[model samples]
Target: GWARLADDPKALARLPTVAPGATEELDLHLSLETRLAEATAGETLTHGDLYPFNVLLTPDRVVVVDWPHAWIGPAHADLVMLLSSVALSGIDPEPFAVRHPLLTGVEPEAVDVLISAQAGFLLAIACSVDSTADPRLVRMMTELGRSSLRWLSTRTRSSGRSKSKG
Candidate 1:
């Protein structure tokens, strides 16, 4: 599980240098896990990893590969993962989000939560693995970790401001 990995000692130890103050925020990932669990109360079939290359589309039918991470969770979780994966390619996910069939009638707030959770998960993965010990791969993973940390930090600040104003 992503949450499990986030809490793993090995995972934390493997993380590259992150932005200032981010370490404190990341240390609270367990609280994020609790929030995710609460938002994901409704169980449904979900393909955990829906990255662009994982799907195959020919002239006929479309095939989805990689199912080892599939599980039962909120429907929006899959949409969140797919959109987040798309975002990794520098594409804006908002326009695509509204058009996706799976995102129909889904709560945006729930998707936000899932996205935040996914970012945290990615941070763990980026930290824990060396990716064949390639220098380029290590750089990419480190960059991803930094990006996720920035995103989480921004979201945390915005959420806190929103709550304080209400």
Candidate 2:
């Protein structure tokens, strides 16, 4: 998610529409990059975009189908992305978070940061696109952006008003 943000300066520039104070918020987050990095020190496989839509389940087994975003990162990062998607689906994340093995030994604050980054990246992309080019897709992105932003705000406030992680 951070890599996505880093690669899209134009989109990042338009993020304030969906996330107010995005520049300062991202700057504060950037300052804590090393700490965030330290929190997930091990090199493990991560499903960079783990979400409900990317998973497939059969009678016999579960399969995670999207591998393009796969990379070496903290295992908890994949869990965080999964929880974020669940939250977007109007599900409470607490129960799932408690049971997920990937979240073992992970800091709650670190998860919050990852979720915020995911929200911010989505908002940037949603705001950057040309709406008229594809109204239905744009509308979907807009709604997703709004939900993600709301989730970000709720997480921030609950976490004592911390700025988002870029």
Model 2, 1-166: lDDT tens per residue? 4445546887777666655665556665454443555655568888777767778999999999878987787868877766666666787676677678887767766766666566655665666777565767665555555555555556667668556442
| lDDT: worst 10-residue window of model 2 | 28-37
Q: Give all TM-scores, in the order shown.
A: 0.66, 0.69
Score each candidate by Cα lDDT. Answer: 0.60, 0.65
Off by over 4 Å in 1: 1-24, 27-30, 98-101, 104-107, 130-166
Model 2's TM-score against the true structure = 0.69
Q: Which ten residues in a row have the lowest lDDT in candidate 1?
A: 157-166
Clashing pairs in 2: none
